[model samples]
Target: MSHNINGKAAGKFAAVEQEFAKNFAERGEVGASVCVSVGGETVVDLWGGTADPATETPWERDTVSIVFSCTKAATALCAHILVDCGLLKLHAPVSEYWPEFAKNGKELTTVQMMLNHESAIPAQREPIRPGGFLDWDYMIQRMEDEEAFWEPGTRNGYHMVNFGWTVGELVRRVSGKSLGTFFRDEVASLLSAEFWIGIPDDFSQPIAPIIPFVPDPKMELSPFTKKLLTEPQSIQALSFLNNGGWTPNDPEAHKAEIGGAGGIANARGQVAMYEPLANGGSINGVTLVSAARLAEMGKVSTATQIDATLLAPTRFASGFMKSMDNRAYPGGDQMSAVLGEAAFGHVGAGGSIGFADPDHDLAFSYTMNKMGAGLLLNDRGQSLIDATYAALRA
Candidate 1:
């Protein structure tokens, strides 16, 4: 079932169209969309493939999909906006806003610590029921009482699940609104993008369910990985995938408002949401943040090195992954080597990706419901990114 590509400026991205058709035919992509906006103009907006695993419904242009960790980039944007307004400070101790965060030797942890995945506060001691994530106070209290897996700011570990609660609490404390509310009012409404930190009630019918990948018996986490999960903080991170975290078994689970991980949007909506950042915090006439703050987001707060917990080398910025000279994101090495060192955004667990490339004045987003096999960016996403860059050069 193929969906129509609507909106103006569609023909300029023939390469992206070719790639989308190729992926649907060759890559087993269930349902997906890829959107690219350059210099405030949407050049590519295409969506197709099947919306459900059963192939009963065609993927609609407005069909939304859960973006998993890609939601972090939007969450980061909320923090950046607060910082720009002087409502929050990036370098100041997080305890200044949310005093309870000072517990467990985290008094010195700053917003940079949470953004860079260095706060060492990934999970809570008490397991949360899948639907209970909406209770912000309970979640924050759990993190406040939980001990750090490693000393704060000592090393980098992916704050997998808790990154949202940690930062969202700060946003709430300072703004008197939850992160989701702030994003909807400040960012999504302004850009006319449908992205959501906590999905809204009206759009519930359009969401594609998350399909988890089958575990490969041959691929196992190393001994270090075993030890990492044993730590209290580590278990909390892994719990996200358990019956508690974003699993599809619970229908009401999608409604839970987990800021860091539970965001949902289609490709066009995701790209539109970030276009302001690519255009220096203003797209068209709307300015979400100032140019100075956007510059701060692109600067590297962490670098390519062996991650403390994952025990694998990864390149990272404040909340975004950096493209290294030797190894670019997932499959970027063989593609055009044109990605600026300043590209910033977040990649989801399976294969979804969204980012703002300031160098190219582009904001690109790709999302799919079908879960892929590998940990890093999956083949479908990498191929689309490669093809997009190839088209730009041509």
Candidate 2:
């Protein structure tokens, strides 16, 4: 299957582009795009392969798909921007903005605590209402009624999907707009980034539907998956399988602001979105935060030996993921996302990712329709990250 790869790779980045195309040959990439920007310049911008393998639809430059948790980075950016504007304080309790959040042992939950996964609203223990994700009020009410998994701020837990409503609700309360609208009117609109937290009903663009992950039958279950299957009452099970009848492939899901796990973007769109953060918080006169705030955005705020929910080592910088080097740990290489030491971003399920490395003045993204095994960056996306860094050093 010699799929056509279209786009440009300037200078040394040509090698990076080659690696992107090679993914189809050596790796199991079904359809994907990789984009890179260095020192505020787009040195590599490429998209290729099929968008819908079932229909044989060519993966055009504009093709987009669900970026899953990568959407967390965008949601976090909206919160931090409010911090930069003095509209919200990082140290302020979430109750300051939404008083209802103060109950259920969350009275002291600070904005930073929520962003760093230290506030303990990791997931709802009971089942959510069917398709409750689409109803903002329903989700918020559930959050209010939910109890903390542990003493808030005592342990770190990857908030997973709930991050959207926990932090996103704060964005809405402070900014007086929905999470998707705030991100668009303030962030995406500024950079002309095509990424969207929630697509509107009138949105006519064709979205590359998500291909669900299929695990190998021969593969051994991880501690997380094993626990999820055996202990259905555990947090791990609740965090994953308890979604309110939402499927990524559904058009209605695309139109809802599931900011934690539902974002639609291509590599170019993600790269463009992170461009300003890599370039000192402003580009083309579109400023997201000041240089000082950008510094805070990239700094690691929490490190845990085993995240309470994911049951794995994790590091978080506010709402973003810092460069995670878990390669030395047992089977950690498969779940690690290694970027520049100062880089901060998020990886979605099935290996889509976007990040900004301020130390290198670089922004990068890889979006794909096909699913990959593992909880983090698979070889398909990590290879591109390595190739991009190699090109940068050249």
Q: List the candidates' TM-scores in order.
A: 0.88, 0.98
RMSD of each: 3.6, 1.1
Summing lDDT over every window of 10 consecutive residues in candidate 1, give the lowest-scoring window: 329-338
Per-residue alpha-carbon lDDT of candidate 1 for residues 195-233, written as tens digits (9 for 90 to 100): 887766665447777777765566554433455457545
Deviation in angstroms for 376 in model 2? 1.1
Best candidate, lDDT-wise?
2
Candidate 2 structure lDDT: 0.89
Model 1, runs deviating above 4 Å? 1-12, 215-249, 324-340
lDDT of 2 by residue, 1-394 (tens): 5478999999988888888878988887778989999878889989888888889888888889999999999999999999999999999888899999888888888999999998888889889889998888999998888988887888899888999999999999999999999999998888889899999889876688888878888865666777888998888888888889989998999999998999899998899889999999988788889999999899989999888987778999999998777777666766689899999999998899999998889999999998887778888999999999998898
Name the weakest run of 10 consecutive residues (lDDT summed) in model 2.
Answer: 326-335
What C-alpha lDDT values do all the predictions have? 0.74, 0.89
